[model samples]
Target: SSFETKEEQEEKMEKSEQAAAAFPPSFSVSEIKNKQRRHLMFMKFKQEKRKQKLQLKKKKKKEREALGDKAPPKEVPKTIENQRVYDETTVNPEDEEVAFDEGTDEFCSYFNGLTNPKVLITTSDRPRGRTVRFCEQLATVIPNAYVYYRRGLALKRVVPQCIARNFTYVMVVNEDRKVPNGLVLCHLPDGPTAHFKVSSVRLRKEMKRRGKEPTEHSPEVILNNFSTRLGHSIGRLFAALFPQDPQFVGRQVATFHNQRDFIFFRFHRYIFKNEKKVGIQELGPRFTLKLRSLQKGTFDSKFGEYEWVLKVSLSAVTVFFKMQEELCCLI
Candidate 1:
């Protein structure tokens, strides 16, 4: 390549400065290099901004596709509707026995030797009037059950006392606004604590009479509309409240209603020996309970479906024998 001489370069620079100055005084020749650098930087900034905008647009498109413009329809499961009958001939006396030895290795054996399983119904230390009343009512409903105020006793202390006293279950009534709104059921020795929502509690007087007033001697139980794993757990819970070998000669019958995952419990005694053909006696209280939520290991409403909190815990097993007894009557 041919190189320009110093005199030629000087002449070219003078000509370029003259051309720039002829346009406007504000367009200074001395600022030409700085202006070129600024222009290049501005172009790079614009390119980066355009790329970011395109990336955002793509992300928004993906989100729209994933969510869909319209939601899909929900699915409903089919259910069976029928009345189940229990034959007296199928009752086996030996099957009614609950062997605590099956899973009692880790816990003490006080409950194993007890002839009657007891339930302790209690409220929080500072229980409201409604809670206290509910506890009393529940104790009456459950056979061999009694009520005691917690009196600020910690769970660590309460649990050991219950075990020592041969109590099979400890029921805690949680209150809100002076009304029983929640229940905590803990199986003794081995745990699998269950939390349940309490609603629509009615005494016998509060319920609408369907037929003749129930007899006083006959005992009855009703399990209404409980289905699935949780339902099974609840049904067993109800069974735990009663004696294993109940006086069936008095015509004790537990009616379970299993429809749409709702459980209704009615305990009464059935009699069909006399000319009346069929008769019923209210053995336990009438109440409706629905399992809308639960927590594993322990009962804490604040961590379940009704609330947003996380807590750790364990398992549930109690009603294998009751379930077998009711299986024959399931329709």
Candidate 2:
């Protein structure tokens, strides 16, 4: 390779200088340092803002506590707006309309005559495995209860058999997609059938077992509707439904809840080292029964009304007898 002459080298340097001038100047170390400083300052500003926000939250929480406003409002899910007909008048008027005398006298007499109310828990014909097991567990919870399979027998057929078996109450477990989802409770010898939604069934065996030895104390019944004045009567009515057997000496606790037209029953047996120290062991199955409707007598479709019938039916006969006595004295 031949070396370039001085004049040629000078011309090349001039061309390079012209080309460099056409473009902007290259970044300097000072400019780079300035950019980094600006970035750090921005980050610091953001961090300070976040810290101030945290402090404000803490202050607000303290203020709320000092004001005695501890509990925040519960957030209920917004119901989906679908084109489903809920108005019974438009969909089925005859089914929704309840006659004034429909569930009155019959409901009164049926519950009034119930001296010994034994329940028969049966599953629907072709019930799923879970539903069959659920029915068995439910029978264990209720006193004087028996479990049976429907065997493709219709309600009409099953009712007579239930009556013949001397079962005062027939509880039919309805299954959906192989799970128990609904319960049909019927009174024997005539009417007032109630359909309830069954959900959240957790068996005792599924519960977390404790290390402590099981207690032998008799189970206590807790009725949580005790806040209201009329809660005592409701509690007593519920307590009467269960049998006080002496054979099972373990302290079994049954909590009954009547909230928003729904009945939730939680049964547990206490495992106690002594009377002062106790731990709970769930007695198989938790029941959440949502009241759907009550039929007047013998599961009549026409008399199916969405009403609080349990309390009313239990008190009806007493009210009727008192009225009759008052009339007799007046006469």
Candidate 3:
């Protein structure tokens, strides 16, 4: 009877071992009291995860290969631009009212070739270091651009003087802690001013693999992804910065690319190496601009009417309530 009891105990122990093997211990590395053991377990867990991921990828590849041409198309990763909500303000080319508005806007004269662009570049009072260089470099990029000292004058006063001098555009670069941080672009005589928060300013000296000094020839301006009515207005504002006629001989290009409400400015020089192959080299002084507000008139912060102002403080749920208030009178 003792021998039989011992054999039964051994059989139970074997069954317990098999059951334990079937369902492995459930645990986390954090539960381990030993530091070294915890680290080792964590590394093993990471390796296991990676292994599983690789195996799954391999399985998917095999399935795709087996399906061949019949396989469903690969899913495209979602991005803010691709997944953006339907915008009611998108410009339609056939809209006559929009055409009329554009035809009579402040930058219309420049677009119509009736008046040449004369940009007066100035900085915030007492600009130092990079801010000064940024203005100088901006002047170099834009044709007929003149750099002027701010002299601690009020923008309202400077505006009238600029109008008297026949300057079409006034660009004021604002700096903080000796770093260029803001920009104000005002179209003259009539109105329509844009304020932008500037960031990621990469000057010529800071760039790597930059091309030689840009030529004096007027560069071709390219505005990309400006689809909405507001975007179209912003695009035109930048387009009016340069002369309409571009010098093909210069091979220089200035691109203002808008994506997810941020405007990225890039300068480059391109060369046609072959019929199909072309090479481009970057010319430096690149920066990013996020629009703060677009005003209907000149730089009057007090009385100017805003066409659009970026709402950062409001939550997404408040948008519907805000829209309802705007449509209250009509309702």
Candidate 4:
């Protein structure tokens, strides 16, 4: 029986060895831990790569800001800075300074010639150059000067045909659309150049009725577009219809400068009335000359001389706009 027991034990040991030999050495606990560590290291490396990309983007933005750059990706509508006024010069800078500093910050004061029942703008500073800046100047001079205009024959012309009379002031804005939150009260002249305060509800209703949205930035764009349009339209019309006229009107274009002020930023129509064989400074419409000192809320009302400066400025702006317009057209 002892011998048989010994044989049985040997047989059991052999079976156990065979089962162990059938399987190759498996992964150790330490090996599995090492594999996991390698994966985590790779994950950390990828995270660092992504962090570097983000850091690069931030650095680029900071560099751009340091270089005084602005984002050029916003879509905008037409504005009021585009418009026209007569050409004149020799503006008394003193008057402009005084008005801006001392006068009430309103536009309606410019249109002082309003009658009790009728209206007409009569600011010391006749608006010139960019219509929007002119309006702003007028507002700065007057308390509540306004410029209002509506196209087509549907809207009834105001009772005070011009821009003056009883409650506040109104002027014919000559613009295509009403400005949102815009307020320009002026004593408007008769005919087309009128201004009025638009009732919010009415303006909203009109926009809704026409299935159009009020501009998010209409004041600046509408005015600017108007001036540009006027410039182009006048240029085309004069070229086509009045080609034979001796004293010709040049292409209409609004000019601007980087004065950082409202007037400086405004785009003005460059009206160059020319005379055959006449030099640039030697020709212009005959306007009554007036001189006055600047006061608070008032300035050199030399808007009549706007044309002279425009002609001079055109030499510079023409190049910028020519290429720009062509590009815009292509786009």
Candidate 5:
């Protein structure tokens, strides 16, 4: 035991020497030349860090417990979205202009309960594998939705046929390399189309511990964190895809949750275990969508007026300054 303690002290001194070699500047495990020494040092460093973190956490818990009901509120961590600049476009329900715009938008017919939603879910020319399955899963989630083959037809021509068939929305899933990558949602009859970049797709089979297949009953729709005028329009567009009355017996919910401009779609089924307890199960087909552009008219990329377009360029500094100036004026 005495000899082991002496060897351990020597190792600790060696580590201290290595640290001091780069002290008051920088030191990293990778800086060690010997691969074995590097691995050993890194592991020790990680263990120390983890130990300190746990000790701090336990200390905090003890402090909270000591104070009991008088404990100070927990500190809120800072995040980009929480610390975002004030958005002037956030919809105010009391604003008469916003109210009028909502009441008279292109989606008014559906909100007025004058027309039922019939959605046409189709894919790009000759969709293969996962793309086809994705479209089929989407159809299952949306009530009154039909999945159709593109058959090498132009979207412009398809839009007219969809309107004639009294379809309220035309959804086109664009695939690349046999993977679903883009989405085009065009409202029927008049205008306002949305294009989204699709990513992080997980099918029913890919999910772990997912619930059984969803039923034919309409699932409740939930739109979260869509606050701006553009967001409101997008929310309304999604809302119009389902019928006005939801079938509560299904106990299923479809959620479109927006965070940092990315929309996450989730389907879930809930069951009540008791009066105060509830359990939820995920029903598959998860995906994320980021708005690429919002056009004023139907899917006409050449001549359509864009309400908003997400532009990525090498000259980001210039664009950032321009946006800051515009925000200053709005404020």
Candidate 6:
């Protein structure tokens, strides 16, 4: 135990020495935050545009339906006609548990005078083999200040970029992102709260009209504040749900840093209907994708999903889908 303690202290000293080897490069936290805000702004604009289109469509569909009511049968496909009249909406009601329903765990409290540390955030734009690698040279410069990372950039998630931003969950940014066996949440029992949420600066500005904070916080604002803590717990939730295959619901289960890289793991999934045919997905405005098959598998006689997993990556995937003989005749 004495020897192990000495070795541990030596390792710590060595890491500290390396962090000090490089003079702290100054970067703007405000600029990064602003960029993040701008990206969010565009998302809002895009969503509103989609909503307008849907609304206009609904109106047209209703008018057509009324016109059809007066006419004979067999004008248009009933399925297609019905789809237009209904306005598709997803309404997420606010969570009932807002006020920290239970007493705070001593470990999970917020602290001030935070350090600006450097850690390798997950970013995808790297050599294929190099994608999964972690940047180890991050350090805390000052208390409650900022984090300085060694890497030039971070990765984006394969899933919706919004999920990365809207989550104000359990992100314990330390000097290193690598989790030791048990010390990941060491500060959590008594950590300072810093929540992150996706909101337009325009929205925030509009809400306050002109003040420090909004006069009356939006329901989402409350959720955003609460969601930061959720970031802390997402590991458990992610583990439970997508333990073997991260892409559980046809949506890519992944992790990303806003300015950094994106990591999508446990990717081998066939939930999407057309696995035999190559497909493309626009993950975000920034990234596009093509799936390459690494190995063709025996098709499930009933389901038609490939039994073999592909050696897939955001880059560096080799796809080889067994061509369909029946489709060849049609082609």
Over 4 Å off, model 2: 1-114, 210-220, 226-240, 244-248, 273-276, 302-331
The whole-model C-alpha lDDT of candidate 3 against the native structure comes to: 0.92
Which pairs, if any, clash in model 5? none
lDDT digits (tens) for residues 1-331 of candidate 2 = 1588889988999999996554332443245457887566557556766988999989877777776857565357555423334433222213332323323433343334445657878887898878888887666656677887778877877888778977677888998888788988777666557677888876556556622332444345667643332333234335544554433566667688876546788777766789798876666577787766566556555545543445435488889999999999999
Show model 6 residue runs off by greater than 4 Å: 1-103, 106-143, 148-331
In model 5, the runs with Cα more than 4 Å from the true position are: 1-31, 54-72, 315-331
By summed lDDT, which 10 consecutive residues of candidate 4 come out lowest? 282-291
Error of 3 at 313 (Å): 1.1
4 against 5, candidate with superior lDDT: 5
List, in order, the clash count of every candidate structure.
19, 9, 0, 70, 0, 52
Q: Model 4, 84: alpha-carbon shift in Å? A: 26
Output the lDDT of residue 99, model 2: 28
Q: What would you estimate as the lDDT of candidate 2?
A: 0.64
Q: How do the predictions measure up, each by TM-score?
A: 0.49, 0.53, 0.81, 0.20, 0.81, 0.18
The Cα error of candidate 4 at residue 318, in Å, is 8.8
Show model 3 residue runs off by greater than 4 Å: 1-25, 33-40, 273-277, 314-331
Comparison by lDDT, 4 against 6, better one: 4
Clash pairs for candidate 2: 191-297, 191-298, 204-284, 215-271, 217-250, 217-251, 218-251, 219-251, 219-252
TM-score-based ranking = 5, 3, 2, 1, 4, 6
lDDT of 4 by residue, 1-331 (tens): 5657887999999998996564322443244457887576557556766988999989877777776746544346555433434324223325665345324323323223222222223321222233343344333222223443332322224434432344333432322233322222222232111122222212222222132221111121112211232232222211211112222133222222211112222212223357544322111111111111111211123332221111124566788889999999999
Instruction: Quantify all predictions' global Cα lDDT against the true fold.
Output: 0.60, 0.64, 0.92, 0.32, 0.92, 0.28
lDDT of 5 at 61: 100
